[model samples]
Target chain A: MLIKSLAAEWLKMRKSYIWSILAALPAVSILIGTANYYANKSVLTNGWYSLWTQVSLFYGEFFLPVLIAICCAYLCRLEHFNKNWYQVMTAPVSRSAIFISKLAIAGIMMLIVQAFFLLLYFCAGKVLGLASPFPIETVGWMSRGLYASIAISAVQLALSIRIRSFAVPIGISICAAFIGLGMYVMKLGMFYPYSLLTIGIGALSQESLTIAENGLFLAMNSLFIVIVSAIAIRYLSKRDVVA
Target chain B: MNAIVSTHNLSKRYGDAYRVNEVNLEVHEGEVYGFLGPNGAGKSTTLKMLLGLVKPSSGKVVVFGKEFDKNRLSILRQTGSLIESPSYYGHLTGLENMRIMQRLHDVPDKNVCEALKIVRLENHKDKKAGLYSLGMKQRLGIAMALIAFPKLLILDEPTNGLDPAGIGEIRELIKSLPQRYGITVLLSSHLLSEIEQIATSVGIISDGKLLFQGSMEALQSKSQPRIAIKTVDNETAHVLLYRQGFHSVIEDDALIVKEMNDEQTAFANRMLVQAGIDVIRIEERRKSLERIFLELTGKEKSL
Candidate 1:
């Protein structure tokens, strides 16, 4: 039943314009980051790591959270469009399957976007004639970034599922992203969903996390995902959803 | 016949007021049950509760002899429904939409094509559902509901967006489903005439309450025929009939006798004529089904 539910969700994702979003955000961020790196080549001597700070700054702080929100909202937009919730809720499937399947799809989308952003980063470095070898720590950044993204997707998916308006959830994500910036400045990044993205991507600081810090980061993200998903599934099961 | 679906005191409340107040619906196997009501009569809420789309505030739903709360998925597996408006992905083609339902229900791929053909949407199957006309969208919704070959079909205003010809076609299709495939249907409509043409049994709701529930013949039987007698003097004729143990009332300048048969009409006319009263007119008027529906719905003032 979960497989079938996943397939149903995947079927709706077909022919949608979501790919354009996945491609545009990272591409535009690379453009701005490369320009900033070239303009600051006088004093910056950290090579690829320096470029990472510049590129991930806009992508992680603002664009990435907004991207997750848009993707989650778009995933639910079809169901909220014309009473499609009635059809899906009445289907012979568990509510957990439906909620989990959407979260999975959002995770997959974020994975693709993360990989694309890394590819663009590498290409930008190569194009700049940077002689330093690619930083191995960047791969760790990408994986952690994807994990944090899935956590954010889970929360956004819950909001999108409850609210019918497409723009409202996305707007809330924007506001939350700003608050996350404040939390990151206070060294409370691991406690908030949006700030986790900033810290995971090393958007402002490219330094590596200690072994204990890495463990806490992963644990915190998992905790948020589980709690948010549980609340969403419970609400879906108990509430009445009209067409 | 066994009841394919039944609700025991099902109710839904919003805040302090009830949207559906203790609606007990019984839909039997091999019969088309029409849920008749005026607008905002809680028809949709009651239907949603039956399908588990809406949670009942204080009651339970039983389908196929199993409680809905305990066996929702299993019960829903055998029931197909199109509630309120048609639901579809505007981006996908009609065929694609049907295929999704087919996969969810775990039916064969061929069932998709067959269901489309049943709704006469086979030719337009490749068109995006959003671009289809309102009637076509409605047909596609019905096709998707039928794709799984569910034993119990619940349709709320299935013919809502169709033209006259399209409405007639769907009406015929729904009427044939029971005999053709043994699918019992629970259909809802605000039009009494629509229910009259399609339903074998009926349940009428008003103000969130089930006003009446019985066979079509039973509802029709409520429309008793009365004898209206017009004489040279209606006042005297009314008194004379009252004295003869005939309960009558004067209305519209005629003496109205309630629930009179052919023999009673003949006897009353003969008695009036021999009493030196000129029997100008003796007409039998059967109350219309529409009037009875209005009265049950508490909208008789509009008539």
Candidate 2:
């Protein structure tokens, strides 16, 4: 059932010009990273994680989360148009299945977008004559960053589904990113959902954080994903499909 | 005959007001049922509840002898519907829209071509649905509804915003659906004439209440007969008709003479000739469905 719903949600997102936005992110990120690397080659070492931090800020912080929110919101908004919500609600599938299918697709897309960012970062590092360093930490940081994206996706997807407006949820997710910078400055990053991307990825790269720090960051993100997603699915199930 | 869909004391209330109040409805298998109501008359809301789209504040919907919410998947597998506007992924082709819907319903093979053929949209199957004309859009909508081979089909205002030809085509398509597929259909429309011509049975609603529900023949039988008379002598015709105890009102060049039987109208026609006035035409005017609707809903002030 989820497979079918995922296919349907994917079709809806693909038809709504989401692909162009997804494709554009890595292209732009790569271009900006390449230029920065070339101008600062003397000061830079052959560090994959360092290069990722430079490139993925453009891809991850600003583009990736907003893209996930847009996709989820657009998936629901398409139904909102012309009362297509009526059709979906009347279908034989369970409402929870419908919500999960959309959530899964958003998660999949988030992973794919992160993969593109990682691939571009690797290519940019090589082109700028940087050698690999702390390969294990680099891999660890990338995996944690990507996993944190899924957690972030849960919160954004819920926001988009509940709010019913594509612009508002995307706008809110972007604003949350900026607000996360303040939390990071205050050293309270582990408390907020938005700070998961930074803290999870930061712990892997900093190499100095205690095991306790890593556990706390990971736990906060996983808890946020579980609790917020449960609330969202429950909220969506109770509310009538109004489209 | 077993009812494919049934509702008992079904009510939907928004706060203190009931959108549909204590409504009991039944649609037997293989029948064409028409739901007639004006705007805000709760026709759409009733359909929504029956389809399990909206949760009723209080009521039980028994579909196919099983509770609707309990057996929703099994019951819905045999149901098709077009509600409000037919919306699709605007960028997707008409065929793609049907294909995706079929996928969602878990139908293995692609039925896009077949659905398009049913709606006479075969040639336009590859075109984006958004680019189709309004009538074409409606046909595509119907096609989508029927694609799953549902046993019970529901259509809400299916002919809205269509030209005369489009309306006729939809009416013909709806009329033939029951016999062709051996399926039951519950269609809602505000156009009385269209429903009168096509529906086997109708349920009329007004102000969140069911006014009447019965066969089309029964509704027609309750309507009064009217005769339209036209004369060149407009002033004399009014004075002479009024004086003869026939209450007649002028409609353009014709005077619609109400409250008079066929014999009385014939007698009035002879009196006009005897009075040296030429009767242009005197024909029996079939009582319109609109008239029946108005009378049933108590909108008519008098006969």
Candidate 3:
């Protein structure tokens, strides 16, 4: 079921002609980052955090989340726009499988967008001639960044599924992004939804995360994701589909 | 014979409005059952409940001897449906959509070609669904319903918006399913003519109630017979019938009476002739489903 669900979403993404943007975002973000790095070789000493903060904001904050929302929204747009939720909900497959399949797709798309961000961030660092900072835990940091982004995408998926209006979910995601900034500072980082992004990017900045603090954050955020997802999926499975 | 599908007092209420009010239905295996109703009469809502797409506010739907709520997946595996408008991803080819759904069903044999052929859409299977005409799209919807070789197929308004030829084609396709594939079909339509020609059993609904449910023969037996009379003075004949305490409607310049058996009609004919009324033609015609429906609903024509 998971594989088929993944395939279904993959088909939607590929057929919707999103591959161009999927391929373009990383390339374009990387080019911009590399050019910025060359223009400020003196600032290369400012370390990987500042350089990455500069690069990832373009890829991560603006391009990546929007791309994630578009893919997630588009995945649902197939059902919403064509009124195909009625078609899909009636299929022999269980409603849980259908909902989970969509969730999996959204998560996978988030994974892809995160990987692209990491790949471009790394490429930008190399082109800028910045000595690799904290080279030992690069994989760990990248994985944490990906994990946080995925959790955020889970929240986005739930929001997208519940609302019928396309722009509303997208608008909500943008607002969440801004809210994430404020949440990152309240020292209640784990409790705030957006703090997942900051914690993730902070971890990648070589900030030490005490296992207890990070674990609590992970647990709280994952719980938020699961709760929201359950509500959305339950609503979809139960409510009479108007379409 | 076991009923392939049965709904026991199945009702769905939307706040104050009851879309389906205690509808009791029984569709036996290998039979083509028709649900006939006008727009907003809840045909689609009832179907959605049967499919488990909409939760019933009350009552139960049993399919193949299993309760729908408990055995939803198991029951759904043996069933296929097209409710309301057919929906498919516009970007995907028809074949792709079927393949995706077939994969979800874990259906063996991958008889996508055979399914397409059943709807006569094999040649156009590779085209995007967006490109297909309405008739073609409806046919593809049927093809999807057949792809898994389900034991029962539920089609709602299968012929709506189709041309006469398209409607005829769908009728033939549905009729052939029982003999050719051994699949029981439950189809709903607002067109009484369509149901009259295709349905073996029919259930009529009005104002969210099941007005009647039985074999076509049973429905016909209950219907008021159509009385056709050809007279030289059509208006005078109509007035004379009214004056004689016989109510009749004007149809194609003829007076059409109802509820009169052969002997009563004969006596009326004798009286008309004796009254110097030139009756060129007098015959009892089969009551159309429409007239039966109107009469059953107690709807009267206004002056």
Candidate 4:
């Protein structure tokens, strides 16, 4: 049942123009990051690591959260508009399958966006004539960034599913991102959902995480994803759908 | 015949008021059951509850002899529905929308083409559903519901937004479903003529309450013909007829006698004349089905 549900979701996803969003956000972030790096190159001694901090700073803190919100909202936009929820709720599929399929699709789109961001980063480093060898830790940044993104996607998906307006969920995500930055400054980044992205990507700082710190990061994100997804599925199963 | 779907004391409330109150509905096999109501009469809400789209505030629904809550997916597999407005993705083509339904229904691909052809949308299958005209979009919704070839089909205002010709086509298609495909349909509409033309059984609802439920013949029987007598002295004629065992009431300057056949009409006129009432005219008036519907729904003044 889940496989069939996933197939249906894939069909809807493929026909939409969502790929353009996945490609555009990362490229724009790179442009802004490159400009800021050039302006401050005199003070920044580390070649590739300094660029990593600059690029990932904007990507993880603001653009990525907004991007995740957009993707999750788009997945649910079709159902919310024109009373399509009537059809989906009546379809011969389990509610769990429907919710999980949408989450899976959002996760897949995030993966694509992350990969493109890394590719743009590599190209930007080569273009800047960096003398130092490629920083291998940046790969860790990409992988951890993907993990945090999935948790954000789960929360955003729940918000999008409950609220009908397309812009409301995205607007809420922007506010959450700012709060996440404040939490990171207080050294409580490991607890908040939005702060996890900044810490995972080492956006504000490029120092490698200690082994215990890395374990805490993975465990916290997993907990958030599980809790948000559980609440979403329960709400869907119990509440009457508005069509 | 066995009932394909039945709801026991089904009710839905919003805040303090009831949207659908104690609506006990029974739809039999292989028959077109017309659910009749005026606007805001809770027809759509009732249908939504049956399809499990809206959870009822109280009561239970049984489909195919199984409880709906416990066997929702299994029951839904045998049921096809298009509730309220039609639902379709504006960006996807009509065929693609049907394909999504096909995958969820786990039916063969050929069924999608066949269902589209049934609704006469095969030619416009590639057009985006949002771009299609209102009538075309309605047809696409019906086609998607039919792709699964469900045994029980529920439609709320299916003929809405269709031109006369399109309405006729869909009406005939729905009317033929029982004999052609053994499909039992529960359709809701505000139009009395539509139900009269297509329904084998009728359920009328008004103000969140069901006023009547029975076969079409039973509903028509409520509109029996009557004899109207216009006499020079209607007041005396009414009393005389009543004394003579004729139940009559004076309305519109005439004595109206209900459920009177040809023989009774002649006898009543003759008796009135013999009593020196000086009958001026005798007329047979059959209450129209629309008037009965309006009267039962308490909207007689609107007529």
- Residue B111 miss distance in model 4 (angstroms): 1.0
**Which runs in model 1 stand beyond 4 Å of their true positions?**
none
Docking quality tier of model 3: medium
Ranking, TM-score, top scorer first: 1, 4, 3, 2
Clashing residue pairs for model 1? none
- For B1-303, candidate 4 gives per-residue lDDT tens digits of 999999999999999999999999999999999999999999999999999988999999999999999999999999999988899999999999998999899999889988999999999999999999999999999998898889999999999999999999999999999998899999999999999999999999998999999999999998888889899999888888888789888899988998787887888889888888898888888899999999999987775
Better of 1 and 4 by DockQ: 4
Q: Give lDDT: candidate 1, residue A222.
A: 99
Q: Can you list the residue pairs that collide in candidate 2?
A: A46-A131, A83-A243
lDDT of each: 0.92, 0.78, 0.77, 0.93
* lDDT: worst 10-residue window of model 1 chain B: B294-303
Q: Candidate 4 — number of clashing residue pairs?
A: 0
Classified by CAPRI criteria, candidate 2 counts as medium
Ranking by DockQ: 4, 1, 3, 2
* Clashing residue pair totals per candidate (backbone < 3 A): 0, 2, 1, 0
Model 3: per-residue Cα lDDT at residue A134: 38
Model 2: per-residue Cα lDDT over B1-303, one tens digit each:
888888998999999999999888888887899999888889999998888877889989998889987888888888899988776667788887887788778775546666777789999988988798888888888888888878899999999878998888888988888898787889998778878888999999887888998788888877667788999897898899889988888886898887687689889999999999999998777777787798777656743
* lDDT (Cα, tens digit) per residue for candidate 4, span A106-206: 98898889889998999998999898999888889889999999999999999999999899999999999999999999999999989999999889988
Candidate 2 has an lDDT of 0.78
Give the Å error, residue A31, model 1: 0.9
Which ten residues in a row are the worst by lDDT in model 3 chain B?
B294-303
Ranking by lDDT: 4, 1, 2, 3
lDDT of 2 at B208: 82
